[model samples]
Target chain A: MMQRRPMIGLALMAVASCIAVAARLLVVRTLDGSLVVGWPGPTLGQFRVDAVLVACSAGAALGASGAILQTLLRNPLASPFVLGVTSGAGAGVAFASLAASIAGMAAPTGAALGAPALAGALLALGCVLLLSRRHGALDPITLILGGVIVGAIASAGSTVAEALLPPERRGLLTGWLFGRIPEVPDMGSLAACAAAALGLTGLGAAWGNRLDGAALSDDEARSIGIALGPMRTAMFIGCGVATAATVALCGPIAFVGLLAPHCARALVGARNRILVPAAAVAGAGLLTAADALRQWIDIGGGRLPLGAVTAVFGGVAFLVLLRRTAAGWMA
Target chain B: MSALRFQSPIIARGAFMFAPGEVAPSAGRVTVLIGPNGGGKTTALRAAAGMLAPEQGAILLDGAPVHTMPAAQRAARMALVAQRPEVGAPFSVRDVVALGRVLRPASPERIAHALARSGLTQLADRPFHALSGGQQQRVAVARAFAQHEPGGVLLLDEAFAAVDPPEAAALVREIRAEAAAGATVLAATHDLSVASALADDVWCIAGGRSTAFGAARELLTRAALPSLLGVAVAEAHGSRGTIAVADYGGILPEAPR
Candidate 1:
């Protein structure tokens, strides 16, 4: 029974992914009402493809980052957004835009924004670690509280940056801040996000066995040949880079990182090598499906924020998971 | 057997410090560290297992300082089974056991054999957290056994405390077999009878000090046991084995001049 779980999960993820792609394709129809497959006039078909790719890549990045953070923190509740990485990235991009305007330069776009965002994410990660650490250890409660505090501070900084921006750019910035996926005008940006997601996820999978050992006590993990400090540092950095890149591309899409890994754990057992990739696939499916749902919902003229859509479902899942695993946490 | 020479002063900040001591487990033999509660048994075992780096002094395995060595290299030379083993998530018994083989090459046959020896073959597919405490301890033993390298050091801290007698005996048999096959085995336990029966050499610790270290038959005497444990000890020799029983309620007698 235990062995078959991962196989079933893989099959389900594959089916869900197929459905997500099919759903996105179906959303883009030609003038005659047929589903647009090849080229549809100017940019309609291409636009949907781009949206799907960005969603898939961003979701993959968030899921892998969450898996790594959960292992490093030894807390199942850990995720990129919970750890303040997303807000930090948002603040970083806002600061960059403000700097560009002050220098009388056009606002930076596409992949050029990922570098600063990554720096901010890493800084936030470091601050959370520093604040929560007590005698070289991190308790789950302290870590979570530290993350929330840092996230709030970063969010405030981002809001101030938005206020400083020119009136014309303010609306677009506000929309992005609410977790709308930005249009990538260039293929380079899309490829960059995809590369960052895949590269970091691959690195995470390579460290999967050590991550499994890390899930035990520090003493036990060391006894099994894992250098705890170095392992945690590596995982933290990987998670930060992946999350920051995704946030730079698609704003701060929440809950996919928090939700996907738990779903994966239910499908696959806690063998990290299998779980990390499984979570990535599940995350992609989840984000794509959420996007589809957002399009279907008639929220006036504008679409609902992707973050809001995911949070509505992911929040309930988190509550259920917390209740079910409360005893495990206490233990 | 691997020669394990542990010389260190273990310091736990704001808690306790184990005074400097050197203990050498004899080659091709089982050595048991017997001590009271809060007496630094786990600290000593941790230092020897390379889990705790000594504030001063060093632990040498085969004449090399273990603390200075890379983690992987140190792990390849020793295996430690903690007193209270915990899994962060619900992993299968097989997956938990596989964690022990990190420093060594993959060997499914070795993992299977260890599981069978620990009487956990039937529970291989079960979630580790779903098992009873005794069963969990046995799973840890199985993992340690799977991790054993030729002429390596094995350190177990109260590993069999929660296990049933039959399973504990089987684990003891496995430890003895490993020692005979050229592995140095050091275990810590509060059970003096089990220690006496299993240990080729015994180190009696009290108040962070090694009060005695010698042949188990000689060091585990009624008088030595009482002095070490702060209780009256009675020994009964039967056809089965020599049993050293402790009377916990008795007050400590005055020291002999």
Candidate 2:
């Protein structure tokens, strides 16, 4: 009953992605009540493709990052957000805009914005890791606590930066924070995010054996010939980089990172080699599907924020998965 | 068969300081470490298993430096079963057992062989967290069995602490089988009855000291440790097969630095 299911996850991903892409391509009602439906020719197709590509890359990074984070922390509840990286990235963009206003300079966009986001994300992750070390090894409880503390502090920094922004500029940061699939995403940010997602997923799969041993106690893992320190250090860094790239591309999309792995796990079991890739595809499908859903639903207002759609739907999906697989988190 | 001999440096686990000492066990034999609680028996086994590094010197398996060996290489040569916290996730019994073969593919037949040898073949599909302590202990043994080379080293610390009499007897058979297959076994246990019957050599640790307490076959047969417990001792048996551990670390003097 517990054998590895490599192809099932792939097949499900293909089905989900194809459906999401068709939905996204076939119809779209623009914000001004102009219904653009059926066969979006070359120019429009290219735009749709770019949006889908950005969403998939960011979402894949998030899902793969979350899977590795949960394993490294040995805590089932762990996600990209738990490590404070996403919030830190938000703070970086927030403070950068605040700095730009004070300096009377135009705010950075695309790759320029991504640089600070990556820096802030990595800085926050480093602090959490540094705070959690005991005798050169990470203790799970200390790590979880450190992540929570760091995340809280980063969230506060974002709120402060947001409060200081002028009303007109504030709207841009607010819209960014609400998360969206950019129709014209900077090609460089998309490429970097995609590379990180694929790279980290491959690394996770290559180190699957060591990760499996890590599911046991520290001493036990060591006995099985796992160099716990080196493997943990490498995997943590990989996850951090992937997550940072995700934040750089998408401004803190919530729940997708946490939920996608569970969805993948439902199909792939916990063997990380297959699980990492499975989760990546699952994340891609989910975010694109969410984007497609946003286009379809109308709530007597302007287009719904991508973040709102994800948070409400993802939270509900998470609750459902949590109820079904409480055993997945057992100590 | 590998012979283990090393001078363990002064090791501190938490606030407890284990004083330095040396223990050399005969090759291809079962050597039981006997000690009072907090007397550094676990520290010794961990050091021997290369899971804990000595502050100075190395644990020599045959002539190789066990502590400095790369983890993957070390795992192919040595296996350890120590008391540990419950596994962190709901890995299947087979999944946990398959971990022992990290250096190689976890073939189903090999995993089943290890599970069957440990008397847990039927429970291979169960989640590790769902097992009783005795069954969990058996799973630990199964993991070691899966990873272990026939002529490699096996270190056990409180490995049989959770098992019932029948399971204990079954595990004893497993240990004997390992030794018979030319592996050297070092187990840290308080069960003198098990030590008495099972051990070939003995390392009696006390007051943070480890001493090579002589052959179990000779000492237990002579009933030499009758006075350690200040009680009646078992009568000598003429047969060479059965022996008792007149063994207690209390009788051994602290080793000199």
Candidate 3:
């Protein structure tokens, strides 16, 4: 187990990001829904607090998933979304919605989507892993290609199922598909997401040394006494489960997973032990910041959707980071 | 003393199987496996390293089954320098070498010592990927050296291939030093000249079967190797007589030459 300095660094970063997010969300809102700096007394609502927790947990889950996926696939570009896990969850939710409509019921949200979403995500992950095996080992490029194909297939299925949903239910599906950062979350869903995030982050941190060794080729890793099968299986499944829980709570936030590790890697070195926690915390920070900014960037128009805010800002940041990363590698 | 024995056939991917064999390279000695490409040398080394499990027989490391040992324990007892080590990220050279002590707390002294031995001390802070192919191979050797316990086994798969001649010579010296310090070393190579210079014992393997040949001095010669190596062999005498001599030249026509 890694001690002291690195763990302290991770803890400090996590706290800083959390504090910054809370500061932003704790402001007072005017009559027209514009937020401004305000004192504490009667201003703080439980809804805002829940939103903060949701962003943090969802972001951390995606970030941890991205870190492990990148290490396992041996590609810096790998992420939970890259493997189409989120799309599989979407497809599961879509099918469940269709089923609900057939039985004359409203489509369930939040915690209710957890089981089906997890099943679909794991199924898609298994299919990708199965298809990616070459000469009895998983090839990184092949895994990416497999993920793309499987994700596309899952998305197509979701679309087909969505088309069959009732009119009112269709609107709910569409809204969820745009992605969410719900102020009022189902308590059970929030608990699951938080648990998944903590578990995945801890797992990544504990298996840090093995994850580092895994960056080498399978034969090299095996020769060093690192069993490739169990390590890969555990990490990949942990990533899948965490990602499914995230999708269930947040409906599929983007870029936090893909970008968080890069941010963390820039701060911490490529060692997975520190990198995993740093990435998870970095993700929490990114999503929390995005949520904070979502609150700030308001005019007479309605508040910017959390999904749109994250996509626009995170996409630009990723491009800039990508250039820097490419230059670093070249250097 | 260390003995690696495959008492039965070992199956690998493709149409490959190690013919039943036994080769015991004692402690404080350099044992070389000399053979043609696609022969069972690498397969045999992998089996000995416990990377491959036997289909019919047991791979024993000094009477104890190798494949049955817990992976970490097996790794602690042995170190392997693979033919081509694939590293994904741009880790520093020292970081790569330090990975050898994955089970133990990293010792800077050990890493530095291994680097010096492998002639890689100057490249310690450099990114592993930035190094040339030969340098990378040296790094792999250094990693194995860092992991090696004095009395433990060191297995090298094609330890001399693709490296520059000078580096390869340096590596031979380093390997010899390791053997002198009581490590049992088994190295596989198609480089017959290096084998002549480095080995105390030779196992000539071909056509998927391994045979325990005699001493490297007696076996690594034009007269002895042509029939065993499936290629024409040539002798080049050096200052140390046979140390820097005897390399294969070309294929032998089945018809009388």
Off by over 4 Å in 2: A1-4, A30-37, A106-112, A166-174, A321-328, B217-257
DockQ of each: 0.47, 0.48, 0.40
Candidate 1, residue A188: the lDDT equals 60
In model 2, pairs of residues that clash are B196-B244, B196-B245
Query: For model 3, how does the per-residue alpha-carbon lDDT over A57-134 read when each residue is reduced to its tens digit?
Result: 999999999988888887766778876787888888888888888988767876677677767777888888788777
TM-scores of the candidates in the order shown: 0.87, 0.89, 0.89
- Cα displacement (angstroms), candidate 2, residue B80, comes to 1.0
Screening candidate 3 with a backbone cut-off below 3 angstroms (N, C-alpha, C), the clashing residue pairs are none
Q: What is the CAPRI rating of model 3's predicted complex?
A: acceptable
Q: Is candidate 1 or candidate 3 better by lDDT?
A: 3
Error of 1 at A118 (Å): 4.8
lDDT of 2 at A289: 84
Candidate 1 C-alpha lDDT tens digits along B1-257:
56788675555545676764777888789999988898888878887876666777778888877766787887887889999998886678998898898656876888898899899999998878778899999999888888778788889999988988888888888888988888888899998767866799998776677878898877778867776778788886844677787756556785697
What TM-score would you report for chain A in candidate 3? 0.88
Highest-lDDT candidate: 3
